[model samples]
Target: MKSKKIPERLESKRLLLRKLNHTDAPGLYANIRDKEISRWLSGVPYPYPKDLALKFVLTAIAKFENKKRFTFGITIKGIKKEAVGVISLEKVDYKNKNAMLGYWIGKKYWGKGYMTEAVKEVLSFGFETIGLHRIYANVYSENPASERILRKFGFIFEGVEREKFFKEGEWQDYLTYGLLKKEYSKAM
Candidate 1:
């Protein structure tokens, strides 16, 4: 399987999974900086500062230099020029041809199927464009919405741990889900 030498932006029916920009800090910060939103997310800290957001965008750009995996700033197609969510591929193993998918969306947009749509677009990119063999999503057991999105993406519930995460000052269970190239190919 061959990875695209150049990173490609993916577009779905309602989204443009484009590259993140430093200018996106203001809009992204507005939606993602709160503890309510960042609670379960591992690296994104509560009360995320503008400086940190800028750093995030910078790091996103830097990922392109390596060329195997990338993240996107999720923007709605018809809406104003702003990011309502962000999604990405991480821990890509080119030899194994796999990557773990992750995402976050604005709270107001929850229950609208936005996250599922975005996940589908990226998974399609991984399997179709990037020639990847597998993709997976992990979530805290309490995050039913994320679990729902992965299920809708055709990921199967694989396993769970007793105390796989420690977030917001407490320990919690982590639910792991995964989809294989074989499974996705069969579904297609």
Candidate 2:
């Protein structure tokens, strides 16, 4: 399948996924600055600085433009001004037709089904629109919510990389999940 260009916006029943921009820095910082949200994210700093958030937004934009990655800011449909979370298909390998999925939501938004909904739409965009053969995600072994979301989308447990990441001053186990286009199509 030939890949299609990612749309400027993707809509779900209650949320909108759009490209990250400079204006999202404040909201992004506010949401991710929480230790609860940042702890599981190996790449994010614990005390996420405001400037780092701005730099992230700018970097996301650059990466999107370069086709290196596609990052989306998640906002409620009626409240699009602020992003409550972020999702991305990073480490894209066009030749291999695969990418790694990563995402996080604010502490306040936990258990609201927002991340699940966003993941569904993004998976569709990845496999159907982007013609990706496989989309995979890594979850901290201790984080069941993330593992559940991936499993809900038909992501099969691949394996565990023991102490693969060192975050918050300790080593963390990483669980890998993967969904092939065939599996995703069957689930849908």
lDDT of each: 0.81, 0.90
- Residues 65-125, candidate 2, lDDT per residue (tens digit)? 8888989999988765688889999999999999999999888888889999999999999
- Tell me the lDDT of candidate 1: 0.81
Model 2 accuracy (lDDT, Cα) = 0.90
Q: Residues 4-88, candidate 1, lDDT per residue (tens digit)?
A: 4655578888888888877888888888977878987878887787788778878887885575457888998888467777898
Backbone clashes in candidate 2 total 0
Model 1 residue 32 distance off true place after TM-score fit, in angstroms: 0.5
> For all the candidates, what are their Cα RMSDs to the real structure?
1.6, 1.4
Clashing residue pairs in candidate 1 are none
Q: Using Cα atoms with residue i matched to residue i, what is each candidate's TM-score against the true structure?
A: 0.92, 0.96
By summed lDDT, which 10 consecutive residues of candidate 2 come out lowest?
1-10
